[model samples]
Target chain A: MAKRLMPLLNRVLVEKIVPPAKTHAGILLPETSNKLDSGKVLAVGPGLRDKTGNHIPVAVKEGDTVLLPEYGGTTVKLGEKEYHLYRDEDIMGTLHD
Target chain B: MAKRLMPLLNRVLVEKIVPPAKTHAGILLPETSNKLDSGKVLAVGPGLRDKTGNHIPVAVKEGDTVLLPEYGGTTVKLGEKEYHLYRDEDIMGTLHD
Candidate 1:
């Protein structure tokens, strides 16, 4: 799948991580539900371009766990796999250990 | 509606601006559809926290048109209206004149 879409400048291709069937607060969420916040980095794009037209580096790398804004990103379905393409700015922050 | 949600910090209460039923490329979109990239700022939060814990100011004010990431933000249904509550980081950039 990574071979197919080349994420444009500063955009990252993310594969959302389905949270455990329950929340930290011990609430059971159904599979057909939406959390509004969840995902993991699948592939990251070259960072945004600086004024000099040079590529700035991205903070998060592939395999990093990250938080996404609930309602922002371009959704693309490759074959049967669903992925989201979004800019680095759309990422809130890296999840802490 | 603004009275209900305080928007926490650096978050904005966005009221999505439906595209004009058409795209710049002359594509018509339906109302029940989701664009993954459309919205107007209804109310803005104070701003992100500075190192000193002071409120950093937001770039865009209320009523400004902005682009939202497609799959980020917490969705809240207040009364009959649907609104997205997201952090300042979720906002991509302000629309230009």
Candidate 2:
């Protein structure tokens, strides 16, 4: 499981949320639309230290859903699943529910 | 100047440093190699707030030479020059020079 992948220094490990299967006029929609800009937090990095050497924790936690940019992030492939590693600040925002 | 491009929320504006020109056997090399992995900080965003609402400042400062990843970051084009905006945590490390 990519959940074992621990990000270092204010990074977050996320698994992109898969969009629900959809059909248009009884025909399946293109797979391209399956890519979503949201994900579930899998793992988080030890927060990075500030100039004063104080540790600043990430805003989001494991199990939290977050908004991801269309680009950026380090891709991690574990078995058949894909995960992404993003700096804490790379996450645009967190989604409730 | 991209220096005027202000980044928000723990983002940084960086001007990529041009690699030293190299010539081999008097043949000018391709410009592709000029794309460097390092840059100088031009501007910085107000630090992001932690879960507790405390602001965490970025580690580096303007004029600081920083290491940048080959991928990621938002590209901003100003005139004929190209700049990149990266989150504070996206900066890999600081280079002393």
Candidate 3:
């Protein structure tokens, strides 16, 4: 049996997208240029209940690329991979193209 | 014109209640003994709107004694008094007795 990560109550599970290690010219890129501020949404919660007990869905969905804040978001390590769990509101915005 | 403090969006205006400087035994208390965790609610917001646009009023009301968290809550100054503005949920609970 395998365990799958499932976000709960408007939480989002994201995998940090690390920038490419080198340029197309075969030159090593500086670590400073590799700002790990973007992530790919791996899973999303089933939305939170409002005051009236109505469900309000999160804005972003799975497979979306999102901008992350410099701080916050709980880091979770599963097996050999590391993922971040953030409240839906903590995600800055979704990236297009 | 005299200005008044009015909280908005389910926020509460609280005035910290500092403990008495001296004990009943006529001994002065140390600063460490004063936790400063209690407050008196002075004003409350009209309530925030839920997803369905329904108003969700704050639980605490004026003159209520509330327990506060050690951190968080924005400091507000009006006239010669200092107050704290906190969201309804940020207030730990209402103190009874």
Highest TM-score model number: 3
Model 1 residue B79 CA deviation (Å) reads: 27
Give the candidate number with the greatest lDDT: 3
Compute the lDDT for candidate 2.
0.73
Model 3 chain A scores worst on lDDT over the 10 consecutive residues at: A1-10
The local distance difference test score of each candidate is 0.68, 0.73, 0.75
Residue-pair clashes per candidate: 16, 0, 0
CAPRI quality band, candidate 2: incorrect
Complex DockQ per candidate: 0.03, 0.03, 0.06
TM-score of each candidate? 0.45, 0.46, 0.49
Task: List candidate 2 stretches off by more than 4 Å.
Answer: A1-3, A23-36, B1-97
Chain A alone, TM-score per model? 0.76, 0.80, 0.85
The TM-score obtained for chain B by all candidates, in the order given, is 0.71, 0.79, 0.86
lDDT tens readout by residue for model 2, A9-49: 88899998765455445656456542326778988988877
What 10-residue stretch in candidate 1 chain A is worst by lDDT? A29-38
Q: How far is candidate 1 from the true structure (C-alpha RMSD, Å)?
A: 13.2
Kindly state the number of residue pairs that clash in model 3: 0
